[model samples]
Target: MFVLAVILSLVTAAVFAAAGLAKVQGAKQMRDAAAHLGIPWDNYRLIGVAELVAAAALVIGIWLGWLGVLAALCLTLLMIGALVLHNRAHDTVQAMAPAIGVGVLALVTLLVRIAA
Candidate 1:
């Protein structure tokens, strides 16, 4: 359980960090996504910051199980919001899959950390 938790946490952190950095750096894709989702650029950047913070927490949580749990939960919620926005935009299932997948990873991380 501990090993699983560590693996999941690292993978989730990597994914979120990459995504967050893209948003923070104002990548073309992220900007387009924000516009598509009707989110303001500033608000989208703040969301990116939130992701980065959560990712950092997950990394730091390697030795601190509680923080890992909290970070995973946060990521899960973020993903939920992403899903909602995507849905509101009438996005295809394929377009929403990333959020669903990452949300599952975050959820699994949370469960594993708790078990560990």
Candidate 2:
């Protein structure tokens, strides 16, 4: 279970880190998506930094159980927030799919850690 949790955490971190980097890079797609979601363009970099921090914490948590658990929990919350934003914006499945997927993965990792 621990091994599986670690693998999941790593995968989640990678996905989110890429997303964070894209936001920081001001990728056109990400900017447009954020705008569509009603998020201010000025906050894009901040969101990206948050994601980067969460990603780092998640990977570090592999060695420190508490850190790992905390990061998983935070990621789960972030995903939940994403769902809410998508719902509020009445976004299409295509827009919400990534959030749903990442949220589920984060929830799984968090649950597995709790079980352990």
Candidate 3:
């Protein structure tokens, strides 16, 4: 269970880190992507930064146990919001994929952590 939790945490963090980096470092591309999801570019940089921080927290939280749970919860919410924004933009495919994927991972991480 502990091993599962660690693997899940790492995977989740990596995915989010990549996504966040893309958004933060690749602003123009991210803005275009956000436009597809109906998110204005105005605060995208901030969002990206938050994502990066959250990703880091997830990794750090793994050692702290409870912090890992909190990080997972935060990421789950972020995924939800992203899904909502995508849906609002009529980007059903894009919205559903990451939302569902990340949500499932977050849930799994939560379950494993609790079990451990």
Candidate 4:
């Protein structure tokens, strides 16, 4: 269970780090996504920063499980917001799958963090 927690934490952190970096860099696709979600560019970039912070917390959480739990909870909430925004934009389920999938992973990581 401890090993599982570590692996999940690293994988989740990596995904968020890449995604956050793209958003912070204002990649074309991320810009388009922000527009689609009706969020201002600055606010969207702030969201990216939040993701980066959470990813860092998860990395530090390898030794301190409580931080991992906190980070996972934060990611889960962020993903929930993403799902809501996608729905409001009338996006297809395919478009929402990544958020849903990552949200599930975050939730699972949270549970593992607790158990471990």
Candidate 5:
């Protein structure tokens, strides 16, 4: 169970880190994508920062147990929002995969911790 939590946390961290960096470095692209999704550009930086923070929390949480659970919850919510944004942009196929993957992994990590 501990191992599963560690793996899940690491995977979630990597994904969020990449996504956050893309949002930060590729602001124009992110803005375009957000526009397509009907999201305001004003929110882009905030979202990027949130993702980066959440990713850090997840990694740090690994050593802190319950913090990991909270981080998982945060990442789960972030993924859910990502799915909604992608869907709004008519990107259902692309959106579903990562959203589902993250959701399942987070859920599994939560369950494993609970069982332990």
Candidate 6:
């Protein structure tokens, strides 16, 4: 269970870190997507920062059970928000897949850690 949790945590951190950096670096697609979602530019960047922090917390929390639990929960909530934003933007299911998948993984990790 611990090994599984670690794998999931690392994967989630990698994905979120990449995505957060892309948004922070002003990737055009991210910008356009945020605009399409009716989110302000500043808020969009803020989301990137949040993702990065969440990612870091997830990775760090692996060594700190309480933090891991908290980060996973937070990431799950953020993914829920992402799903809502994508829905509002009327994005294709393909575009929303990552958030859905990641959100589920986050939930699983949180549950696993708690069960441990």
lDDT winner: 4
True lDDT of residue 75, candidate 2: 84
lDDT string, candidate 4, 92-112, tens digits: 999899889998988898899
lDDT tens digits, residues 52-108, model 3? 887888899778888888888887787778777777777768547866887788777
Ranking by TM-score: 4, 1, 2, 6, 3, 5
Candidate 5 residues 1-116, lDDT tens each?
Answer: 77877887788778877778888776677778768778676687677788788788878887777877777777777777878777766786755686678767766666665554
* Per-residue C-alpha lDDT of model 1 across residues 2-103, encoded as one tens digit per residue: 888889889999999999999999999999999999999999999999999999999999998789889999998888889999999999999999889988
Instruction: Output the lDDT of residue 74, model 4.
Output: 95
Model 3 TM-score, all chains together: 0.86
Deviating ranges (above 4 Å) for candidate 5: none
lDDT of each residue in 1-116, candidate 6, tens digit only = 89888888888888888888988999998899788889998899988998899889989988997888888888889889989988988889998997889889888878886876
lDDT scores in order: 0.92, 0.87, 0.79, 0.94, 0.75, 0.86
Clashing pairs in 5: none
RMSD for each model, in Å, please?
Answer: 0.8, 1.2, 1.8, 0.7, 2.3, 1.4
The 10-residue segment with the lowest total lDDT in model 4? 105-114
RMSD of 5: 2.3
lDDT of 1: 0.92
Candidate 2 structure quality by residue, lDDT tens digits, 1-116: 88888888899889889999999999999899888889997786788888899889989988888888888898899889889999999988897998899899889988887776
Number of backbone collisions per candidate, in order?
A: 0, 1, 0, 0, 0, 0
Report the C-alpha displacement of residue 75, candidate 1, in angstroms.
Answer: 0.4
